[model samples]
Target: MHPLGTVLRSRYKIIHPLGSGGFGETYLAEDLDIPTTPKPKCVVKHLKPQNQNEVLLKIAKGLFNREAEILYRLDKIHNQVPELFAHFEENGEFYLVQEFIDGHDLSKEIIAGQPWGEAEVKKLLRDVLEVLVVIHQQSIIHRDIKPHNIMRRRQDGKIVLIDFGAVKEIKCLETNTQGQVTSSILIGTNGYMPNEQANGKPKLSSDVYAVGMLGIQALTGIPPQNLPEDPVTGEIIWRDQTNVSDRFAEVLTNMVRSHFSQRYQTAAEALQALTQSPPTPKSDRWRSLSNRKVIATGGAVLLGSIMSLYVVSRYFAKSPTPPNPQAVTPQPPIVTPKPPSTIKKFSQLPCDSDQQLSSPPPATGKPTWETDVYKYYGQINQKTKEANGRGLMAFKQNNFQYYGDFKKNKRSGCGRLSYPAKSNIDYYLGQFENDEPQGLGYLKLRNGNEYRGKFAKNKCQGEGVYIYADKTERDGIWREDKLEGSDNFSCKGSSASSMPTISFLSPKPF
Candidate 1:
């Protein structure tokens, strides 16, 4: 255990031990560099290889550094992720400094005997799914995503994901007859991990499976380990254990399907499904029809038929049976055409916005076209249209809004576009030409990823600085949104002057 009051790098003073796991120990600490009334507290994690063998230790060290890099990048892009402050080796162990979150882990809230209501479970699903979307987009999987790893922030009640300690490549060394070593490692939690993950071939959907298990646990009040599964199909049999809306039940069932193909492919897809309205059941539709309307229609039809029959009979009696050579002509029964079924169209989710393009009026300053465009577009507006001066056009829908300068009715000069509602990207403050992003500007995505540099026709092009979510910056030339010939600039939080210079020493034999 790290000594209490012990200081690292002459800055972070260890307060006390927080927790320990198979690979490392964590501690609460205070940053002495800042001269605030009360020094800010932070978390310090010590990463030590479980195996002391030289070959295994070397591999573990490499994995540890890589994990640090992942955490650093992810923190920059996601608010829910913990920030990495510093990472360095002390003695034989690697230590990481990170922002401290004062809150209780979700395990405390999800008690074993207490079940969460539909509303509570739904809220939890949204909160966690949003974070997963960012994580998956970065190509990083949180192999371990249980209640213990999730914390509810006391300040804002936001769910914060902690512990990237499990984000490492496992190495299992094997010796052949010729004395050559080969290695592989499988990583995941038993109850939450899917078959693919357990087989060491985890995909993005593996994380989705874990989240589904979490939802099930919340609803059933039973821990994942205690829950039962089908022996042949391997699907979780959870519906019988809890009472939830059929829509939510269907969603959870799809999410935790035995086959990854049957599950929601991505976090965004899962989120859309969660927020979507469920299809009305046939029985429920009949219930929705008004009883009075059905009775009134039936009564009207019956009375009309009786009246027609009486009138026909009276006419027949008055005219008498006319025996004629012509046989009674049989008329075709009245046929009523059923009204065409109206297909219900569901509203598109925010994630679907990427497929849609907003088309404003052209450079023509005609009032009629402008008004018509506004009416057709619904949310578009000609905020300011001067004869020859720079004009401003605005488009807004819900939380997304765009204000740009227009020349000859086309987007020109600088513009600001905000899309807080989008799941993929956020706002773009940059140059525009012909209503498209062109020249230089800054683009900030919702996942905390940002690019500052040249853009052409709305794609990242030419020289630019791409800052990843983990706070790593890459400076290079980009083509069609792809970074090319790029090199790492600098770690965001660490500085040359403040960071300690280190020289590796020969490893002591185990």
Candidate 2:
């Protein structure tokens, strides 16, 4: 353990040890470099090797750097994710400096025997799922998600996900017949982790299960491990323990299904279903009636005139003529059409924007045709004569073309910016605002590298993940096309400066 007042790198001065675990220990420290009135406090995680082994140390070093990189990237992606300030290795011991979240963990709020209301549980689920949506979008499955790992910030009360130590891929000094290192390091809490995660084959849906289990604990006032399960199906049997709406209960049941395949594949899908879930009934009688199920035709069934003979006998208690089971004609089940989506569809655009022209000339030679930065075609404002609504714009100078929705002469909706004349395929297809890829979008470069995430002002901003041609990914927050963080390590080869970098400059095709 680091002694009090010990300063590492002549910068971070340790204040006190926060906690310790099997892998490492965390300490609260102060950054002396920043010249603030009160030295900003940060959390320092110390990862030490079990023993001095050359091969094991090399492997652990690589794993530690990779984990730090992941955390550094995720920090920029969302506010709820703690920011990673720096990571370093001092005297064979690795350390990570992170943002000190000033808040208490969910364990304080979700106490045993102190159950939360349905509304409170629902709010927690929504908050966690929203953060999971961002994390999962980068193809990351948070193996460990529990009350202790999640904190409620004291300032704003937002749920902050902490402690990604489990995400690190570390292995012991054990080799198989092929001389490849092998170690089974199962990462996750017992109660929160599902079966698949426990077996070390975790999926995005596995994280969803953990979040659902947390919600159930909050509602039932019982720890997830303490909750009873079905003897046959192995599903959690907690409905009788909590007073929640059938709609919500069904959602939670599906989320915690024993089979990963039965659960929602992604957090976004789960969030959508949860948001659309109906509210609780005003009366228990109404809920009971709504929850009623239809029995088989041969048994007691409840419907208008299709009541079975058994149902008629029990309800009426009188001899009534029942329809012949063999003669009864079965009617097709009625399916209610889903409500129209609130988001406007790009296909609803009035003009055909997919048509690509070889040059900047219109086929019909319309007189409204004009040019500024590029040749414009399709619809135009009758009064202002500016490129408005759905249209196509081609720039011969940049050898680029744009096709899709436009508003008031700006690309303000769904659109595709591509370079047809180029030897390689390069394009950006997604939401646009003022001729820039704004909000969620996909950018694929000619070199096979791709970026999938949020953008703003023609730059990769907010949470995004850049996928290299070799399949390795870098996930984090971006501002004006740059990742925001600093890394200075003293290890032999674990310095962030030694790591390779990639540029995501906007092509300015628009």
Candidate 3:
């Protein structure tokens, strides 16, 4: 190991030893050549060949230079990868100086026996997989991927992969008299390595297995080696130890499958599966409405309050797929009802006949018009024939679907608006004016963020409470959707009334 304060190439002043691996030792150093108030610090990796044979050294040098060139390209392409400042051969020793990430390793956050929540684990998977996507796109495979090798950057809280196995892999290189190169040693942790990887054949999916093991360790609160394995199938038996959704569990399982071919072929494939939204179940559609209503009411009335709404008999004609109360398209028709329909079905609606309502509404929109993406059913003005009272708008396209009060076809009363498919916002349940959210309401986002308090012209204004996915709560005043000040605010009138929007008095049959 280089002694403390030792200077290399008359430039890098070695500060201290970082760690030692099978092939090399790392040191923290200061670059004196770089002109800065405080000299920039960098990580120096010293790789020493096991043998001094002239033929072996020549082969190793070639391999080392080739790997360094690719790493340089990777650094320029992705900020997450450390930038390769310089590489040199000093007295038969190979040294690599690179950008030093100012953050602790993931092992600190992923403490053994201290499990992380599903949301946090999911975020970690995305952060790591995104970087892997860029790395793999360049036809490079990260042979070694573990918690200790992944750094959680303090500046922006991004994940940075470190300690590429090029140096370590070179240790296994050997050349025969025929001048052919061969490798025998595997380059990965045993617990995280799959069968193929352990056989000295690491694939892109090998890195995916390591990341999957990291997630399992966080979820189960157990080290990868300590986790039980299925002896018969040779797969890790970890599902019983964690409380994760079945869909998410399946993704993780597929990533860590024992067979490399059975797993996702690339990081991009794995990331897509992780973030893709699962199809909503058929039974949970109306139950979600009742549940949201119960939550909005703070469990004061439960399902009984929603049960009081008058149900139109037309909804009973067909059992449709369950719908998530989120918007479908960028534009919707509720804000401005269409002109008098030539279909003549508007006059056929049973608006005056009232009846007791039961069960929940289906996901499909009524009338099934080929051009119309949404259909509104409720009170209509006798003279103008426009939506004039409480109504339920079902959407078939990607746009906001409103369930609330209306005046002259404009959303101007207490109601809930479902977000579109691509929007980060989930559902906004509160008061509306001129077809936009206004006044108090509860807004839920797809990323597990929630805002409750006040809104004006579709922006978060006035005092509100912002709850982050990590369970951090911020009570503050916001302007134009940005938090400006911290203050106490009450969200009392945000809840919608128990009165249903779709009353039996006005029903538009398909």
Backbone clash count, each prediction separately? 6, 3, 9
lDDT by residue for model 3 over 185-287, one digit each (tens)? 5688878888898888889999899989988988888999998888899899999998999999999999999999899999999999999999867566556
Higher-lDDT candidate among 1 and 3?
A: 3
Return the TM-score for candidate 1, rounded to 2 decimals.
0.53
Worst 10 residues of 1 by lDDT: 343-352
Q: lDDT order of candidates, best first?
A: 3, 2, 1
Over 1-510, each residue of candidate 2 has an lDDT whose tens digit, in order, gives 889999988999999999987667889999999999799999998877765577877777787888888888898899999999998887777888999997567775676887777776777798899998999998887888998999766434467999874534453334568877654456788888889888878999999999999999989889999988889998998999979988899889889999999999999988988899475545743434334433344234334445565565675565366645444434445689965432212111111112221123442354346455456667866777666666776655655667776777677666777755343446776667666666666666667776666666666677666666886666666776666562421111122132111122122222
User: Model 2 compared with the native: what TM-score?
Assistant: 0.54
TM-score rank order: 3, 2, 1
Q: Relative to the unseen true structure, what is the C-alpha lDDT of residue 373 in candidate 1, on a scale of 0 to 100? A: 18
Colliding pairs, model 1:
72-470, 73-469, 73-470, 74-470, 363-408, 363-409
TM-score of each: 0.53, 0.54, 0.58
Prediction RMSDs, each to the true structure? 23.0, 22.1, 24.6
Error of 3 at 95 (Å): 1.2
- Give the Å shift of residue 217 in candidate 2: 0.2
Clashing pairs in 2: 73-476, 76-477, 77-477
Winner on TM-score (1 vs 3): 3
